[model samples]
Target: MKSSYLRASAALACAVVLTACGGDDGQLLLSGTISGVTKPGMILTNNGGSDFEVPVPANGTGLTRFIFPNRISSDDKYDVRVKSTPTNVQECKLFQNTGRAGFDVTTIEIVCTFKTQALGGTVSNLKNDLILVNGSDRVIVPAGATAFTMARVAQDAPYGVSILANPAGQSCTVANGVGTMGPADVNNVTVTCAP
Candidate 1:
C-alpha cells in the first residue's frame, strides 16, 4: 500500500508540474483584437477546427478583443480565419492570424467594414435646376444636365429616387427609381423632365 501511494503521488506531482503529464500540457493560448464587428453571426476557425462565434455587445458594445476557448499545442500550426460575417458587414479580414503556435502567439486583428454603393443615373431635356431625393438623401440637377448621381446608399438598402421639384412650366417623372441597391452601382434610373 505504501509503495502504490508513493507512485500515485509522484504521478500527481508530475501532472501538476506539467513535466511529463498528459493533461493541459504543451498548450498555448489563442487570442487577438477586433474592430468594426457590428451586428453578429461572425464565425472564426482555427486550422479548420471548431468554430468560434464572436460575441456581440448589446449596450455600449466594445467587442474589440477575443480569446478563443480552445488552445493549440505548442509548435503546432494554427491557421485562424473568418468563416462568415453578418449581413450588414461587407467583409471581415484577419491579419497576423496564421502561424505556428509558440509560447506567445502574436496579436491578431480582424477588421470589418459596412457595405455601400453609388446611386445615380441620367436625365434628359432642357430643364431648370431640378431637385431629387432618395429617402433623406437629395440631389440638385442643374438645367441641361445629362447625368446625375445622388448620395451613396448602403448596400441592399431601399432607395426611392423621386422628383422633389420640377423646373418652371415643365413636368418630370422618374422611371425605375424605386428598388433596392445591389452589389453594384445603380445607373439605370431615367429622369425625363420635359413636356
Candidate 2:
C-alpha cells in the first residue's frame, strides 16, 4: 500500500509541474515590425488591457517583441493596436486589427508617411473681391471668380477661411469650408457670397 501511494503522489506532482509550465497548451509569442518611428518608446495594448509602453527598436526598422506579463491562453482573441503614436510624425496605422493566438504571430506591420495634398474650392455668387485665409497664407478671389486653391497643405491640417472684406457689397460666408485634410486633395470647399 505504501509503495502504491508513493507512486500516485509522484504522478500527481508531475502533472502539476506540466500544468504550471503550460503543458498541452501551446505558448503564444506576439511580435511585429514597425517603421517611420524614431522615438524612444510607444504604447501598445493587448485585448484592450492595461497599456504596455514598449521600447521602440533603435534601428527604426526592425521587429518589436511583446511579452505579456501573464501567460495567455492559446486560441484566444488578441486585438493589438497602437495606443499612442510618436509626436511630430505622421500617424501610424495598423494593418491587421484582429488575430487569433493559434500560433506565434509575427506578420503584423506598421507603416507611416508624411505626404500631404492641396485644399481648394469654388466661389459662387461673388459680387465683390474677397481674400481667403488659411493660417498665414491667403488667396484672393476676384469678382466673377469661380474657384480658388491652396497648395501643399499638410495632411490632417485644419483650415478655416473667412472673407477679409467684400468690396462688391456682397455678404460672403464659407460652406463646407471647415475641416482637416485627408489623404486626397480637398476641392469641395465652397465659399458662397450674396449681394
Candidate 3:
C-alpha cells in the first residue's frame, strides 16, 4: 500500500511539471515605434496576414506602437502594410519602406532607422534617422536634443527607447533643453523638440 501511494505521488508530480511546460499558447511580445510626417492618426495594418494594427500614437510626434498576444511563427511571413486615411505621401513612404516584423531584434535594428523631425521645425521627417538606443551603459547622442525618451508598456522588462534624426537624410543637430531617460527607471518620455 505504501509503495503504491509513493508511485502515485511521483506520477502526479511529473504530470504537474509536464503540464507547466506543455502549453503551446505562449505569447509573443511585440514592441516598437512608427513615425513619419503624416497626419496624427495613421493606421498600421497587417493586411490580413496576421492580427495586428498599430495606430500612430497621438502627441503629434509620429510615434506609435502595439502589442500582440499571439505566438510568432517562423514558418509564416507577413505582408504588413500601413494605410493612411486619405493617404499622406511621407507617412506612406516611411511606414511602407521601414515597416517590418521578425523574431530577431538586432536585424530589426540594422534594417530600421528611427524617425525624427525637421531641424528647428514641428514637422515629421524620416529620411535621416537613427536607431533609438537605451543608454544604460553607453551615451547616445541625439541629433538635436540633449536628452531623449524611453517608453515602455511592460513592467520591469528592459524597454528600448528610440528616435530618428533628420528625416531628410541630413545630419542635423538635436535641439537643446530636451530630457532623456533618467537613471534606470524612466519608462516613458516626451520631447518638445527634435533630437
Candidate 4:
C-alpha cells in the first residue's frame, strides 16, 4: 500500500510540473465541433481511439467549450465520439461546439441533407458552407440553412479533448459563435481534423 501511495504521489507531482512548464507557449484555446449523424448523444474520450468521458458543458447541442492545460502534449489529444444515428436509411449528423473563440468551429452544423454519393449517400449544403465529411460527397451547408438542426452534435466540445483528420484538403473549420472562457484562462492547444 505504501508503495502504491508513493507511486501515485510521484505521478501527480509529475503532472503538476508538466502543467506549469507547458504554459510557456502562452494561453491557447482549442475549439471545434463533433457531429453525430450515425448516432444520438455524444461522448468525449481522452484516448486517441475510444474509451472514457471528459468534462462537458451543462447544455449540450453537440456544442461544447472548455480549457486545456497550457501545453497540449501528445497526452492532450482527445477523441470526440457520438451515438447520433438516423432512424432509417436516411442520413443523419451531429455537431460538437468547441467553446473557444477563433477556433476550428464555434459550432458544428450537421444534417441528413438527403443522400449523395458515398457511404450509401451524403448530406449536401443545407446552409451554404462547404464541409463534407464521412464517406459522403457533398458540401457542408451554412448555418441557418434548412436542415441545420440535424447538423450539430453538441453545443460545445468536451473538456480536455482534441482531434485530427487526414486528406489535407479535407479540414474542419470553426462554425461561428461566442466563447465562454477568457483568453488568458486557456493556452497551447490544437484542434485538428480527426479520422
For each candidate, give its TM-score against the true structure.
0.60, 0.43, 0.30, 0.21
lDDT (10s digit) by residue, model 4, range 66-118: 33323223324333333333331134454552223333322433343322211
Query: Mind giving the per-residue lDDT tens digits that candidate 1 earns over 1-195?
Result: 999999999988986766356555536788897776656788889889889988875552435677788777777788889988877678777799988877756498888776888888899894688999998887889999989999988765789999989988899999999998778899999999777
What's the distance in Å from true for residue 29, model 3? Answer: 3.1
- Evaluate model 1: give its TM-score: 0.60
Candidates' C-alpha lDDT: 0.81, 0.71, 0.38, 0.33
Judge candidate 2 at residue 52 and give its lDDT. 69
Q: How are the candidates ranked when ordered by lDDT, highest leading?
A: 1, 2, 3, 4
| Candidate 2 vs candidate 4, lDDT winner | 2
* All candidates: CA RMSD (Å): 5.2, 10.3, 17.6, 21.7
lDDT of 2 at 147: 95
Q: Which parts of model 3 have CA positions greater than 4 angstroms off?
A: 1-26, 37-41, 50-53, 69-71, 85-91, 94-195
Compared with the true structure, model 3 gives a TM-score of 0.30
Worst 10 residues of 3 by lDDT: 104-113
Predicted model with the maximum lDDT: 1
> What's the true lDDT of residue 87 in model 1?
75
Clashing pairs in model 2? Answer: none
Ranked by TM-score, top first: 1, 2, 3, 4
Writing each residue's lDDT as its tens digit, candidate 3 over 69-163 gives 45443322434455543233222443322333445211111012233222111212323334443434222344444343433222212334334
lDDT of 2 by residue, 71-169 (tens): 445677778788877553467778765778777776667665545777888988887778888878778888888999865676555677666676467
